[model samples]
Target: MVLAAAGCSENAMYDLDGGAMDAAVVEARSLEIVGDPTVSLAGGDTADLTVQLRDPSGAPLAGETVRFALDGRAHDSTLETVTATTDAMGLAHSALQAGTVVAAFRVRASADDAASVSFDVAVGDAGFGSMQVTPEYVGERETLPRVVVGLFADADCEDDFVRRDPGDRLQVLSEDDELVRFLGLPAGVSFAVAVRAEGEGGTVLAWGCEDRIAVEALETTDVDVTFDDEPLVVDGSYQTTSVFPTTTGEDVATALEGARDALLPASDATLILDAAEATLSGAEATELRAARASGFDATYQTALESLGPAAAHEALIDRLRTELTSLTVVGRLRATEGELDFSVLRLGMGAGELEVALTELTIETSLDATLDSEELRVSELLIDLSASELVRALATREAFDRLLDGPSAWLASAASCAALPPPEEPIGCDAVCLQAACRTVLADYWTAALTVIEALDQERSTLELDGSANVADLAGDLQVDTLEGSLAGEWTGPSATSPEALEGTFSGERITPPR
Candidate 1:
């Protein structure tokens, strides 16, 4: 009976052990996260997660199926109802992938009657920096009422790139304490920034830019920009080459010199007139009259002799007809006080009379100009012909006929002159004929005088000028409407102390005096 009872006890113990194992499997009612309950991941990255199955006695339960359910969805990776069987260690493994946004998501794991365990995952990047700018103005900030800042992807600041919305721009207002911050900038990318300030009437008061600023992950960059109230001044010299108008075959320089030479003796007559002014009584008066008459005669003779022949007369007239179509004047420029001042120290006309007389005439002119990008504009030009002594010398010749015509005509016809009959008590028809002949010659002198004045008038008025200047060369065109013509030219002068030179050519129709 004792042996039988012992055997029955052993069988009962084995059955009890099997029943405990079955109960343990049925009692696994909860899932617990094996490691950290929360995981952090960058966008487009993944994290491994594990959940353990446990019984009511806190013992591991194997071969149970665990399922995962995510609160949110990503563009990539499986985060829905994913199922995995627990291994011998009672752990089920899964992976959670992050999307392209920065946020937090919840993930829950459960098995049969087990209570679900919740886990959190943060999806985003923390590798961005900040940028701040301090803007400076030449005047008060109040004078600049508005400011705008722009960011670009190119060194030239062209308005393209995807760092921001296409139409979005930044305005740093004084009311906002002038602090600006940008977050989530991608690392290792180049950027450019620009700033502009608006004044009263919406005018742009100041502007500046930073062409290249590299933003790094987890860093901050500081920049400063300045806007100046004063105008920019560019001081430099230029060189040029030129060609003149070829409308007329005559040389322009020769015409000017001829006019000058014709008036030389007449200019000297002023001295004789000054001496005669003091000796105006009886015999002295007679002597003065005779001296005056002789002077008049001599002047007429000199003028006639100068004409040389009919061909010479025509040559002089042809020279006067030649128009200056092209001219080049190169010099240094000093821009300041809202004006560009151009000083032409050297100028050359063709290799004719004008070139020879340049030293003696001292021709010079000043231009008030404005500059834009690569262009130079002449706003006003000051050319003073009266400043030249040679020009002043022309005054006597201009009035020559008025001063000497009467005296010269009287002396030639009344005195013993072969060209007329002897003067009677009153000058008769024969004397009149001789006087008319003399007047004919005086008409030619007047014609020459008028031509010189007309040419000189071109230098006395405002001119329209357009041109451009670059690092290598400078060029321009000058138009004088009153002269009915234009001059185009170019110049070169790289050195400041050395000289800038210019050359140009001209074009125009021949000018004829009114009949």
Candidate 2:
């Protein structure tokens, strides 16, 4: 279990300058629990808890309302005072009664927007045991941020322990060389232990495994896990020789059209119609009229006009296919996880005045090895889109006007106007107000676009290889043979979305030594 500490929460009030406003105008800046972080008590024992609330300059904030809540089951554990106001010392107090059951729980103290902290409480006799793990290689290297310990059922230590469920694991956020402990584990069971050193970006740098250890009730199990002398690494390059046949231009067009229509909810139709009347006229107004009669194709044309012909959308998909089939992918193995980065692809229209940029695709790989089985599972793919850049370039009012070539100019001669002219302006008319609405419409369009991009990001495909190697080999140049795999859409285990196993072979070869 991770013991959380009280941290400072930002509540900045800025004046006209970027500098912070006066501290008197700010609320509580931090909230800290003053009692012990861990409490061990027999059943029916009571513990008093106190929290302090402070302002920006570390001054006491008196009379502020503080709230207390329980996180997990402490059996029938109850907090006597659920709420309390701070005293002159910025402290608030509450009491917790340890109930008639043996369980572990946490008490959380919070106040308004101030940061919160939690304390672990265990109410039991001698039935529970603790595991204390120390890494053997930490003294020889730099400190890491976190150490993850997993208790697995595999006695021989063959299973992928990193992917195990929550109840059997402990992740302690700390600097290297600190002893990590897991409390409240059931005793008298022989289990394997997996320990990994997590560095920046949560990357596993070193790992060790030990098997067949028994724990005794009411006592602490001390174990030392020996990790790699140094972090393992691999550098290489690979590429896809062929694109997935199922990926099509029609799919791209359908995604774009769906994103466009989602922005025009029924309630906003009247607002869009009024803005359209004030901004679009002459040939453009007539174009929309004839298109809306054709059904859903009308909404597609409305957004597509600024993007050019329907064929342009198809061309972009063709470019995506070409880039995947031809580009060389750079890869690296940072300890256990393998990452493949694809080259950036640029899809453009209107002589490159409007462009959408596609960046790298990262593929995570896992190696499994045992006497009976040796395989590598590569999945968890993410395709990064230039959504923010696209919004700035194409989803703004200025871009709309540039693409349509000043449609508001034709509004002057139009007979029916949905809005009145602004004061002190004759020809300005509702064109300015209509433009403001146009900004809202475009903002909604990009919001929908971002939603589509997020879904696309989660859409993963899987591939597998038929063999694995010792973890030490990852520090040098490593290569894998051609392997067959499957392609699927957003697969979580097996379901309707899982596709048939596709026929293809891709291999990897390392190019550089460990970084």
Highest lDDT against the true fold, candidate: 2
In candidate 2, which residue pairs get closer than 3 Å at backbone N, Cα or C atoms, i.e. clash? none
TM-score of each candidate?
Answer: 0.26, 0.35
Worst 10 residues of 1 by lDDT: 472-481
- Name the runs in model 1 displaced over 4 angstroms: 1-124, 127-130, 138-146, 152-169, 172-193, 196-223, 226-515
Candidate 1 structure, TM-score to reference:
0.26
Model 2 local distance difference test score: 0.46
Best by TM-score: 2
Clashes of each: 23, 0
What TM-score does prediction 2 earn? 0.35
Error of model 2, residue 436, in angstroms? 57
lDDT of 2 at 286: 62
For 1-515, candidate 1 gives per-residue lDDT tens digits of 00111112322211110111123333456567888765656778877889988778777888889988664322344463388888887899888877775443356676786545556454556654446766666643334545555444323445333212211123343433554444434345455666655433434445666657766666887767655532222333332232433311233345555666663334322322333334355665565456555564355344344222232234334433442223333334544434555444333323322221333444455666565333455544443322122222222222232343332232222222224332232211234433344344434443554466455343322223443332211111111111112233222112223211222332211122111
